[model samples]
Target: MADTLTSILKKLLNQPTAPFHEYHVRAQIEQYLLDVPNVELSTDAFGNLLATYRKGKHKSTPVWALGAHMDHPAWVKVPGKTDEWEFLGGVPKNLVEKKENIALRKESGDMAPWGFPVVFEDGKVHAAACDDVVGCAIIVAVFKELSRLGLDATVHAAFTRAEEVGFLGAWHLGKHWPFGKDAVFLSLETSRPVNGAEMGDGPIVRVGDRLSVFDHELINVLMRTAAEQGIRVQRCLLDAGACEATALQACGIRSVGLSVPLGNYHNLDDDQNIVSEHVHIEDVKQMINLIVALVATKHDGLGERTLEERVNLRMKEYKKYLEIGNAKYEEMTA
Candidate 1:
């Protein structure tokens, strides 16, 4: 499994410009999924890959979408230079050094990075494409584990494209997908340490993001489940960014985000940090356990609240956290 993850990471790094041109990565991941028996697969026009594992007892169970973006920021072609390049926002420099070939590309294209170095390495680069690839690996790992345990949940393993550009694929999936609004949506993305989701510690449960806040009841349930299962979890809020869950929450879907803390995000090269290396595998194991429990557990009196209502409630929650944070700061200073 580690070897497979390493190979996938190498492939993703090799194709740095994988936003809309992720056909190669898609093919590779599809092949990996095909190796799992009894799994069904499908793709959408937008290039979102969906893998389904059906349960015999819950044949009609509503689908729960677990997603991650398959795109990363890369230098796009500009007007003049054929071999010039710049760095994409949040890409780390250490990862860039791993590339064997360095070339400069033009600076006029849609994905062009402003004033940063555009790099082209000759050999495979494993670290650069891990921003979302790690998330992808997590989803794949979860699928494998579920299959091994013979669990039942109509789980949709989604790999979306063009998230770096503007969350385009997620917007489409959340708005028009055939799944019901009540279906739980979990976005596997990268998180930072400031929000308490640190690399090497455990997976993060995002309570709120820049785009939309997660469903409160679901968040509470996740927290409780994590506690009951002895899973290491961190509560976090993306102060300035969002993920695929944003679109789902907007569409009245009960959503949350699970992220592995990353270091050196959005910089040129991968020199920022090594926090992800510390993300304990045990944390991932516990996260998968919680997911399985959620799918298998049944409830009759779950409240029916609109997304707008959830958002309102989340805002209050955010304010409370902010106040607590402020008090802590004051205490430290005093």
Candidate 2:
């Protein structure tokens, strides 16, 4: 299983991708999942690929849509200029000022724009585009496993575009909201670590991003699922940047986030040199396991315990003390 998962991730991480130019990445994902049993794939009006897996008699309510973008920060060909290329997405300007041997083509005669090479070595994924390609690989693995097991549930995997520029695909999907308001959107990402979150610790049950906090109930659900399955996971706010969850949440859908800690983010090292981004192999594996566990767990009202219900439960122990104190105070006043 580890070998198979690694192969899938390697294939995806090797695909050339950039903001608004995710054709190669999308094609690779389609090849992985197009023929899986009990799964249906379709491209939305916004060009986001949506794959739905359905099986059995019982279905999990308020469906789970695992989402990840297919693009990373990379160079793209400028229009009408044979030799001019423009970089897209966010990479520090200081790092690219002296662009000398920074960009390398993967193969002879490969016509894709400038990007770093991809390699998986020493139990780490070194690539020009690990930011969300790792996230895409996770979704593919989860969907394939679920389809093979034929779980009595329905879930969707969304491969979005242009997340590096902005959450453009997600924003459009949310505005249209094909799955209605009952679904929960989970944005899977490979994010720069912050707030003590470290690589190799495990996948993060992300609490929030720089923009806004995620759905409270959905966050509780992820935490509860991780605990019950004993899957080690970190919980933190990756405030260095925002993810697609912010876009979906703003559009009035319940959205949350999950991520693996990333190093040399956007292919920029601590010394501001262009290099391949990397992530821990163990963290990637754990994230896959955690998401599968979450699907098997029951979701009906799992994390919907209201604040009122919680207060009432605690009040049982403290109500008598409050009553006695109130009576003594009234007697003294009289």
Report the alpha-carbon TM-score of model 2 versus the true structure. Answer: 0.93
Q: By lDDT, who's the top model here?
A: 2
Best by TM-score: 2
Per-residue lDDT of 55 in model 1: 67
**Following a full C-alpha superposition, what root-mean-square deviation does model 1 have from the true structure?**
10.9
List where candidate 1 sits over 4 angstroms from the true fold.
Answer: 1-17, 59-63, 78-126, 268-286, 296-334
TM-score of 1: 0.69
Clashes of 2: 0
Candidate 1: lDDT over CA atoms?
0.63
**Deviation from native of the Cα of residue 129 in model 2, angstroms:** 0.5
